[model samples]
Target: MVADVNVFVGQQRFLRLIDEETWATVPAVDPVWVDVPVTDYTVRNRPKRRNGQARTGSYQRRYGANPSGHPSGNLVTPLYGFVNEDLEISLAQLMMEWGFADHEVKFPRSKTAEWQYVGHDNDQRHLGLRVNTATLAGSEAGIVLTLELIGQSSVSFTGAASPPADRNKLVEFLFEDSTFTLGGTPLRVSQFQWSVQRNLDVIYHNSHNPISMPKTQFSETFSITPMKSNKTYDDLRDAFGMPELAGQLVLKGLHNGTGDTGNFTVLTIDFDRLSLIDSDESGGTGAIMNPLTFDVLKPDTADNGSAMTWTEAA
Candidate 1:
């Protein structure tokens, strides 16, 4: 038996991050793209099915007699990738998606109403999914980024149309400039993580797609470490009513040159103010650091703000 020529191999399928200007319509040319070293990703369009069962004479369930109607459900996708010393170019998209105050995309996502631009004007078919949540974490083992997009049913079945021309390989964490600070003081920790999530409410209007998907609210969480020292217990023995502090995390790569931009990656996040939400002592085979979690909030000291500075240099 001959194999099908169109059968896809695992390695043949790749992912490219498309910076959509309007809804999910992928541009035909000059599309702003991000090269990602994605470990895994999936595109799912789930249909909410309806069953028509009738008992004319007896009771028997059959799998037929369905209406030729459209069913709508959530169209979702989750993209996962590994972060390295030589991080990929996905930083730009991630920064904008995370909605940094000054860097957020302000253009009309819905050219007309809330969801009118579901590739409708362009004659292309796509769902109105938007990225609502994302997470970035790093530890001794590795670094990872997880992004989730969710919205109403799609107008068409589609995935990444084409793979990026360059597939960057993962560079092990090495020769890097990384630091974590709280209240302008360094903290010794084992691991760290941060997440940004938008509270989206989708409005459906008896169709396969939504009329609007608006973000009602949003939140940001930061975990600077599993502190090796019992700074909490050592000082006060109390957890609640602790003082708030400003924090920062800087992750940078080796210096290739004075003004070079492509050889090293840079990420600097400044939290205007942070309050400790949770802290737990831990024991492990690795560093026995205290795992700490914080709720990132807007600054209260003179009304400062949070900011994220980034550079993509893979």
Candidate 2:
């Protein structure tokens, strides 16, 4: 029986401004901006096994006989050992789609001068007010942010052939489309990490003497950082053919690599933090955005067979 797998997002705290009246009326104010900490996400995988069946009285008597004694009932033995593949974590962005409104209001001027109007009281006040409000309704979507490798130790088995040729393929299968349930939603993997163990110990045992069998075990670890993908209110508007604006919508991802786990490693190839900074110089703000950390799993698809392209869900 395998234990329950556990995954968690580290704690995240940020200040959110709100209208006093609105705060009093609404249950909670939706966060306008979020800063995901560097220590907030974790993935844990474990394996389990059940006890072997008990021997019958006749079988026990037969197998328990001394070596000098004659054999009794047929001897019974346990069958099947356990085998587990690698574990992985992938991250992607999800589109939030709810709670949006746009409205306009006007204040008519009175001809009577019972009370003088305030300053800027031109002949006719023409205010072009556009009041738009929306909630951070969609799900979080983006490429796999990071991969935390655990239990990389290897154990040698005698029955199977050494050095399976499909080791890399096996790792890829475990990571691809690995989905986790978070906040009642499904999260997908965007990237993966591969840690290879160089040396492994192999043990052998003779049928006559099980205690004399030799055994060896090795350990290794790997990790990957997923990409970040959050669309701001402006991005949504533009996508829907609305006018462009100046404000930005920020999305953040938090991960924790310190818990008994090993240190997190970065494996980016082409775009580094510097390249992201350079993108800010252009008219695009998306370029300024990048994952807190990440690892290169394989060649990027968009590289025209040269590089890998990773992005959070949208």
Candidate 3:
């Protein structure tokens, strides 16, 4: 091939997932792949060098020339997309990575997502992958992956296959129609976002960036915008000094299906033992608002030892 001057576009990033036993490697066979609708993405696989230090702080800060490539900036690989098309596969992937699958099965139609730690981990839980190229897709020949984002084991993705037009519905959940509650009571709020932080630590058994990133510790946090009507006097006291572990968040999702709507999609997230991290009475404009932030943790065996539970209703 003589001097390939091929120019690629920004929207060429695509992804796919495949199951594997090893890390940083995919199967030789080209499996049937599906596309995961990734709205934003990034690729960074170049081996980052550990800067050598000078003896006794000799004012040394010189290094080799580091030139950046296209979409240049920080390194990133956490692709964001709505993994709701196949809730079964999506939550199953998370359960395998989290390693604590004590999910509640009360609701037959609704599926609860959580980690597991009793017997063996699911065989199809992890998908090992490697990152070496600084480009997404980049006109490469490969299939797409729709499997959920694997944390314990890395996400295995092939090349060049954008999400189907029908699959990529550019829609977001309406916040106004949704509901929020504190200990089951109504909470007049504006915005809310919660996240599970799996304190993952990379374990490399001599491989140059092995795909083993384990979630050693886990924690959850929640933040919500509350109006004056919702922020009561007791709520203010909870934010002072030492906060108490006495709150539960019951957040409801929207149902967007039309005909033949059986049960309707209702995503219910429940946090049993929630504590106020900080009270934000910053006094904002218009009705004077104060946002709320709280952290969550599972109680001991006395309370069943479950902090969070998310149910996906179909």
Output the number of the lDDT-best candidate.
1
TM-score of each: 0.69, 0.16, 0.57
Which portions of model 2 miss their true places by more than 4 Å? 1-40, 45-47, 55-148, 153-314
Error of 1 at 231 (Å): 3.9
Which residue pairs in candidate 3 collide? 15-145, 16-144, 16-145, 17-145, 99-116, 100-115, 100-116, 101-115, 101-116
Q: Can you write out model 1's per-residue Cα lDDT over 105-177, one digit (the tens) per residue?
A: 3221321101121223312232444656667667665565565656444343333344433334334333124
TM-score: the better of candidates 1 and 3: 1
lDDT by residue (161-279, candidate 3, tens digit) is: 43456543323333443566776677666666555443334455644443345444445566666765655645656657756455543322233332124323333445666677766
| lDDT, candidate 2, 1-314, per-residue tens | 99978533222111111111221121244422111112222211122222334676553332222121110111111100111122122111111110111011111110100111122121111111111111111122322222221221112222211222322211111232233322233434343222212121111133221121111211222222233345332243345432211111122222123112232211111211110101011225553332221121222342211111222221
Tell how far residue 92 is off in model 1, in angstroms. 5.4
Residue 265 in model 2: lDDT? 16
Each prediction's whole-model lDDT (CA): 0.51, 0.20, 0.39
Give the Cα-based TM-score of candidate 2 against the true structure: 0.16
In what order do the candidates fall by lDDT, top score first?
1, 3, 2
The CA lDDT at 294 in model 3 is 72
The total number of steric clashes, by the backbone 3 Å criterion, in model 2 comes to: 46
Highest TM-score: give the candidate number: 1
